[model samples]
Target: MAVALSRRTVAKNALSQLGTFALSGGSKAIAAIMVARTLGPKGMGTFSLSWTLAGTLAFVAVLGLDNRLIRELARTRDPRELERSLPLACLLGLIFGGLLTGIPALTGVHSDAAQALAAAGGFVAVSAPILIFRATFHAREKMEYETVTCVVEGAVALIAVAVALGAGFGVGGAMLGLTAGRVANLILCLVLYRRLWGPVRIEIAARRWLGLIHEGWPLAVSYSLTATFLRFDILVLAIFHPSAEVGMYGAASVILLTAPLVAVSFSSSLYPILAQAEGLDDEHLQSVFQKTSRILIVAALPLATGLTVLATPIAEMLFGSDFGHTGRYLALLAWILPFRFVNHLFGVVLAATHRARSRRLAAVALALIANLALNLMLIPTWGAYGAVAATIATELVIAGLLLAGIRPLRPILARPLVEGALVALAMTGVVLVTPGGIFPQLATGGASFAGGLWVLFLWLPSRGLAAFSATEQESAAAA
Candidate 1:
């Protein structure tokens, strides 16, 4: 019962994180739509490229230390470690922030791209330290601070973007809005830090900092590669195609990419629990891993199905008519959601099992190389469609690699995947037949999938959803 309750607690925290992502992603999604509609394809393309550049560099600013910091804090509960890391992150932020600003200025791109990059530079500078604060909350399982900041940031972003677009500030203004939101989020996080952790410490030692970097460099490499590969297609697109085509791909990719955050939220909540786990072979760890895989499949399938079915209308409604092919791009990319979600779990599991340094890095390196090769080959011929193809193919390859490498997690996927597919197919039928807008289709699809799961798995004893809990309870009793 205690173990069951603990699992429930993990689920609760996961929900809180998911809620944070939902609100934050919602605001950003709206902001994206506003940018797309107001700016059209050319302007939207500039904004997308500029934002991706900032985000990719922000990974460098943190030195890929966020996850490692979380795991360490979860294990050690050391405040001094947190204090040391905060200043380091801020200092790196300032340095990388300069790089973000300088590159576009030096290259002499369009004024809009330059302004967007400059604003994004400010964003990186202000936002780097927030990562430390967020890791602290995540490791401690105190997500309410995150929740508060997410809401405030999202609201601020929406208002700022709306005001910018209203003022005809263009791509630069949209970028500034994003930076403004991050600034607010950073300030709020600082206040929360003081209130919860008591005071701010700003001491840094070079030797200790280098030691931390030494420990984190490998993870940094993996993370940077991961970030770059994910957005490399955009860079390629910008090179070979016009901004309008890039915008179409960007508009589609943004919506589909946000779906992975759901998996990240659940995995974040699970990480702390998994850190305390005995080993990869531990009974509780195995049970929870299987259960998590099941839950992610169940959550992701309906979303992927709905998006694939409604991609065209969603694209038309969100970005207006200028983005003619945006819906087709989204429809193709929607299939990646399930694979991406499960890959996120594979990563967390690898980290928890202490194999992240080698296996995970290898997997990401392979995928990154593949992505680059595929993009180079596909982009010139297929344009934006080529980028979509590369993304889907890369996800599938990486998912296979991760699944094959993580032996314990392999068997857990088959059942959940089979069940999820059936439910998704049923939901798709309902969605197709239902004669209404996207909202009604969404509602009915969700209802049918939910009803199908309950009836098939919960109501019927033959195919119970409680198998893991039952196994865990029995194991506990036996012990």
Candidate 2:
């Protein structure tokens, strides 16, 4: 009964995470379209660069403490202990945020006053506390609460940006509104957390800090390296290429990258569940891992293939003809989805098994190698296309290396790879036979994609979605 209840809890959390992704991704797509139209490529490029830098800074500020806290609190189940630790986490974040902002300012990376880099920096600093508080909700498994907060935050950010733009604030105004909305979200999250968990005790202990750091530092290093590799292309483009090129690449990246969000949502929800289930036998753990891998692969493959086939029309429809070139990039990026999804599953498995150091080492080595090789090989010759190729190559390497680390997950990944190839073949055939027009292509392509999914789901007995049923087979397996 306890096991059943835990499984249900995890499922519910996964659903909530999926909801958050859907709402946030939808809102962000709309917001990006509007922002691009208003600011044009140059302004969009400027904003993208600033936001990227801010994200990197924010990452450094948190230093993986939130992840460490979640893992620890999952074991301890002591609300009071978590409460006491929250403020300390927030303080550490703020200090880190301040340092991130101050260093950038001193270096003159953000020289223009109109750009409001300082204001953005301040917002990033305050955001640390908000993130710490939010992490507490996850630690407690109050995922419904987390979902609601995510929805509200996304909605607020979207509405605020629209209003700010309408009020004639341009990009600067948009930034201000986004910052304000984030602050509001932080406050609300803190209030709700306090109400539900009681006033968290504020305590700072060297031992506690050291413990978290020991666990978190590897993750932080891994994340930083990975992020740098993934994001440096934009910075490179902003310097070497035109704002228009950056805009096109950014647009394509935004759409193509949405494929991974589903995988991420599933993995995020699965991690804590897997961690808690560590007491289970190795066979059980392997079984669960295999099941989850199958589901992720099955889901991610069809979407990626469909997107790849329909990349041109979709890009045009989403961003207008101003982004015609984006389709090619989107198509190129589509191949990385299956690899990334499988890689993410292995990563989660490693982290949940407390093998983060090994995972971090693998990630760092790949990131470093990919960054240097890709930048040298791609950026100089092919421009954005080169960058896209570099990205695909890097992700493939990362995925390959991570898979090498997890021998158990390899067989599970093979089934999905086969399914993905089948789906891609179907999509290619449809694209070839369909008429040239966008609508015709879309209609035939959509039908073919749906058909492929139906076949895959019916024919392939994935263990992940098997939980959705309670038939004779599952009963037999359980017994």
Candidate 3:
């Protein structure tokens, strides 16, 4: 019963996180579309550049502490420790914000772009502490709090961006709207934290701060490298190509990147569970890892396949006639989903197993080096396509290396993978013939895919996802 309950808890948390992403992420997607359509390609390019810069810096400011904090807090949910960490995170945010603000001025980009980038600096500052609050909730396994905060942030940002665009504030106004949403997010996080765990006193515990940084720096390097490789392509492309072209890629990215939140939400839900299972043997850990990986693989395959097949329609529908070519980029970028989705679990497994700074760092570091070299060589000639190639290659490299590093815990389910591909192919065939508009095409595609999965289950009752059904039961029995 405890085993079933634990599995159910994991599912519940994963579902809640997915629901949160669907709500908040959906709003953000709509806002991106609004910005793209209103600003057009050139303006959208500037917006993308500014966001990539600001978002990358904000990630760096995290100092790799979020995961460590989660693990620590899970071990000891002491408010005093949190009190020390909160102030440090905020200070780091302010520092990174300053750095982000300074870059645009130094680089001497256009005035409008500079202004937008400067505005985004404020986003970094407000967004920093929110991570800490999220870590707090994640540790306690009360994901509903994080869900509430994220939903409010997404909604607030969407409305603020809409109003700003309506007022014709342009790119700078869009940044302000995003900043406003994050500010609201910060406020809500504090309110929720205080209501649940009581108010935390902010103190300048300098020594502890240094120790925390010292402990987290290795993870920070790994995280920073990951962030840099993932986003630095845009910065490189912006340097080589025109803003209009950059905007085109950015539009596709708005969807391609956002799609991974499904993987992220599920991974976040499972991380704490893995952390709590620290003393479990390798066999049990392997079972848990394999089960979760199978789940993500099954979910990601159809999404990637569907998007690849319908890229043009989806892009044309959301971004409109202006970004029609974004479909081409989306088509290619969709293939990265399977690798990216599975990669999320690799990091969680490594970190939860206390190998956070092991070969995982080496893998990411090598990937970053490859990413930079590829971007420099390709972007100068192939432009945005070069960046896309680099990003996809990087994800594949990381996934392959990390999977190898985990050893004896192969999570790739062979039968499901083959079966999933077959189902996706069938779904693609249906989607092509039964189409009036994007909506109908999507509906038909979804139904066909569901039907395919059901038919497969009926014929092969003990195959695919069901084959691993006993993983958790065995673990529970062992415990």
Number of clashing residue pairs in every model?
0, 0, 0
Candidate 1: tens digits of C-alpha lDDT, residues 251-332? 9878876767778888767877777765566677777778788878876787788888888988888899888699899888
Q: Can you list the residue pairs that collide in candidate 2? A: none
True-structure lDDT of candidate 2: 0.70
2 or 3, greater by lDDT: 3
Candidate number with the higher lDDT (1 or 2): 1
lDDT of 3 by residue, 1-479 (tens): 01222877787789878877777667767877898999899988989898888777777897977767888887788877678788898999999998767767789875878889888899888877988888888888888888888788888999999999999988889989988988988888889998878976887888888899987777788878888987888889899999989988988888977898878888878777777654324556767777778767776788898998889889888988889879999999999998888887887777676654566788888888888998899889999889889888888888888887777568757976987788888888888898587899899998987787677655466565565778877888999
How much does candidate 2 score in TM-score? 0.86
| Runs with alpha carbons beyond 4 Å of true place in candidate 2 | 1-7, 99-116, 206-208, 277-281, 424-455, 458-479
Residue 395, candidate 1: Cα error in Å is 0.8
Model 1 segments beyond 4 Å from truth?
1-5, 108-110, 456-479
Model 2, span 1-479: residue lDDT tens? 01332567767878887776666566556666776777766656666666556656666666776666677777776775565456666776677656545754577664432354555675577667766676677777776776776677777878888998888776656666667667767777877887877875767665677766676777667666766776777778777888788878888777755668778778778766666654323565677777778877876777777777788888888777778788998988888887778777777777666644565467657766876688767876788898898888888778777777765445455767787678767876887788777788778877877777777776444654565575767788989
Task: State the lDDT at 456 in candidate 3.
Answer: 67
* Candidate models: Cα lDDT each: 0.83, 0.70, 0.82
